[model samples]
Target: MNASPIFHRLALLAPLLCLGFVSISCTGYQLQTGRPQALTHVKKISVPLFENKTLVPRGEILATNSVVDAITNDGTYHIATLHEADAVLEGTMETITYSQVRSTRLDTLRSEEMENTVTLHWQLLDASTRKILSTGKATGSSRFAIDANQQTARQNALPDALQRAATQVVGRLTDDF
Candidate 1:
C-alpha cells in the first residue's frame, strides 16, 4: 500500500548493490587473474634433451619428461620436437648432492631412522626470444626407518624425492608463465 516503505528499502540497498557491481567489474579486468590466456603465439613447445650434470643417470631425462608431461596434459600448449617448436625449454642440472646417514641411536649399532635429501637447480627460457622466464632451485627430502641396510633405503627414497622436486619445478614453470 504505501510507497514509503518500498522506497526506503530500495534506497538502503542501492548503494550496497552498486558497490558490489563495481568490485566485480574491477576484478574482471585484473591482469593475469583469470584462466590463463591461450598461448596463441607460442602454440608449440620444444623441450630439448636436458643435460644431467648429476652423478645420477637419466636425472635430467626424468625431469624433462615430467615437464613435458605437465605441458602436454595442460591442454594449452602442444609439444614439439626440438627444431619444430616456437619455444624451447632447456635445463641443466647444476647440482645433485644428497647424504644418507643414520639419524637415530648414533651410538647404537642398530639405528632407528635414516634420512635422504635431493637438491636440484633448474631454469626455463624462451628459445625464440632467448628470454629467461624463470630460474630457481628446488629440493625434496624424505626419511624412513631402516632395519639393516642404508643403501637400499637411500636408493628407494632418492627417486621419490627427485620426483617431488621435478614436479615442483615443472609446475612452477608452467602455471606461473
Candidate 2:
C-alpha cells in the first residue's frame, strides 16, 4: 500500500492543528479591562487634603478633591478613610506659574488666553507596612481664556490644573505594564 502525497501533507499539518487547538482550549482566562490591577496587594486607598507650597490659595483643597475623585472613578481601588484604607496617598504642590498663551484679535494689547502650570510631588504609602510604595514630582498645565480679570483666570485654571494633577498623581501611584 502507497501513502498519497495529500496524506503526507495532512499528517504534518495535523499535529500543528492539534497543538493550536489544545493551547487555545486549555487556558480559560479572560482579561478584565475596566479595573486596573497594577498594584497587586493594594485595594483601598485614602486621599487626604494635599499640601501646597505655592502662594495660590486653596490649591491643596482642589488637588485633594480631584485626586479623590480620580481614584474613585478608577474603580480599581476603593476610597477609604485613613483608618480603613490599605494605603494612603500624600501630595504636595511645589510651584505654580502662569504665562500668556496668546494674544487675541480684539485684545491686541493684552493676552486673552493664559496657561497655568503646576509642579507637584506625591507619595503612596502602605499604612500596614509603614513603607512608601511610590514617590515622584511632575508638572501639569492648563490653558484657559481670561474672563477680563486675572483672579477669574486663576480661578478657572485652578480646577483644570487640579484635575490634571490628579491624573498625573494617579499615574504615579500605579505601576504601568
Candidate 3:
C-alpha cells in the first residue's frame, strides 16, 4: 500500500508534538513535600488541657480536643506526649461572647438570631526550655437561631466555633502564615 501525503505529514508531526509536550511538562515545576522552615525543628507536638476563663462549662475541654483533632488531621506534626514532644501547644479559652445578629420583627429589643464567638490565646513553646516559639490569638464564631432554650442553642454551636479556632491555630503553626 502506498502512503498518502496526509499520512506522511501526520507521521512526522506526531514526534514533534510529543517532544513539545515533554519539554513543557517540567517548566519550573517542583514537588514541595515538607513543613515550613519556621517549624522545621518541631516535628511532634503535645497539647495539654486548655484553661477556660469564660463562664461556659466544659469550654476548655472542647477547645483542647478541637486543637488536638486539627493537628492530627493536618498530619504535619505527630501528637506526642509531653516527654516525647519537641513543642508544647498550650491555649486558653479567653472569652466566649455573644451578640445579636438579627432582631425579632415584633420586638426589636429581643434577638431572633445571635452569634456565639470563642476567642483563644495560644502559645507554642519548646518542650524542654519552655521558651515561647509562637504566640497569638484566634477567634471563631457561629450564628444560631434563638430557640425557646437559648442556653441549649448556644451550647450546641460551641463545638463549631471551637473547631474553627483550632484549625486556625494549627494552620498558623504548620504554615507559619
| Candidate with the greatest TM-score versus the true structure | 3
Query: Rank order by TM-score, top first?
Result: 3, 2, 1
Stretches of candidate 3 exceeding 4 Å from the true structure? 2-29
Off by over 4 Å in 1: 1-41, 73-76, 99-102, 106-111, 147-149
TM-scores of the models, in the order given: 0.61, 0.75, 0.86
lDDT of 3 by residue, 97-175 (tens): 9999999889988999999889999999999999999998988999999989999999999999999999889888877
- Model 2 scores worst on lDDT over the 10 consecutive residues at 31-40
Q: Which stretches of candidate 2 lie over 4 Å from their true place?
A: 1-38, 104-109, 175-177
TM accuracy, model 1: 0.61
lDDT of candidate 1 over 1-177, digit per residue (tens): 667988999999999999999898888564542222333356677877777777766777766776677666665567887677776767665565554456454566555665656666766556666776567776766776675775676666766676666666656655653
Candidate 3 has its poorest 10 consecutive residues by lDDT at 30-39
Give the lDDT of residue 148 in candidate 1: 70
| RMSD per model, one decimal | 4.9, 5.7, 2.5
Clashing pairs in 2: none
lDDT against true structure, model 1: 0.66
Candidate 3 clash pair list:
none
CA displacement after TM-score superposition, residue 109 of candidate 1 (Å): 7.8
